[model samples]
Target: MHLILEQGDLTTVAVDAIVNAANSSLLGGGGVDGAIHAAAGPRLLEACRELRRTTLPDGLPVGEAVATPGFDLPAAWVIHTVGPNRHAGQTDPELLVSCFGRSLDVAADLRARTVAFPAVGAGVYGWAADDVARAGVAAVRSWDDANPGALDEVRFVLFGPAVLAAFEDALASV
Candidate 1:
């Protein structure tokens, strides 16, 4: 599996799928979630609404993922996963790991050859960038090992240089 770190807009990624660090609501909130919803246009929200009415009545639980059409975004699909928030008292590192793992699991089910991810809990959720990088990289690496060549590439599309550096460091360690 090819792992890459790129510093850019997640909405611009032309991958088969891009992972959104969403809240349980599945409805758009701040950070990556809001930006993705905005970029993907109103239809994205409508799709999410349909999901809420159907499968995710309560909301997407932490570490679980569900996919929706990318709408106006460059990606073909948008995979949304709720990360564990430290400020909210969800501090388990494994939950962060599950965010990456389950997103990939969903991508694999969709036959997505390329996927992009943001640092799952590194924003308003208050997760440290380095810790997020470690868990994110490890989960992707572990999934790659278990699934063999299921995915061609998994890119961490960070918005800033610092977080990108952390992901690069984590990749080097792996």
Candidate 2:
């Protein structure tokens, strides 16, 4: 199924899980990470810290995810995935796609039918919104192809109009 697009508060979504655009620390920084952490409450940080201790290399690979309880948010769980940092050609476009791919994989494993995702790598990482949107659409298309009927709903919860426009444009092409 193709992913749905929306601009809203991720904290209020009723999906089974939500994807956070986390940093390497997993401690919660600015943008979506901070918003998720704040909404999920302080316990979320402690849980992340515990997960961090066991899961080495700081963050999971580009196409993988680590999950934690939602704590206080409406969702049941939070799937934290580390996205590529945009810099002088360092960020692979494929890795950007992988971030979405892996997040869905993790959500599927949790038996989640619906998921909400923030625009990955768009804020502090400095990835262009349009590029991120394209990658996200490609990732969701790949996932839907592999697992038909596995995901009932996927929502791209954009933070702003530019991000929403990027996703809309990408979705239009799909």
* Candidate with maximal TM-score: 1
Q: Candidate 1: count the clashes.
A: 0
Query: Which ten-residue region of model 2 has the weakest summed lDDT?
Result: 55-64
Candidate 1 ranges with C-alpha deviation above 4 Å? none
Q: Score each candidate by Cα lDDT.
A: 0.96, 0.88
Candidate 1 lDDT, 1-174, residue by residue in tens: 899999999999999999999999888999999999999999999999999999999999999999999999999999999999899899999999999999999999999999999999999999999999999999999999999989999999998999999999998998
Each prediction's RMSD to truth: 0.6, 1.4
29-78, model 2: which lDDT tens digit per residue? 88889999999999999998887788654656654678899989999999
Report model 2's TM-score to 2 decimal places: 0.95
Supply every candidate's count of residue pairs whose N, Cα or C atoms clash at under 3 angstroms.
Answer: 0, 0
Per-residue error (Å), model 2, residue 128: 0.9
Which residue pairs in model 1 clash with each other?
Answer: none
Q: Best candidate, lDDT-wise?
A: 1
| Residue 150 of model 2, lDDT score | 93
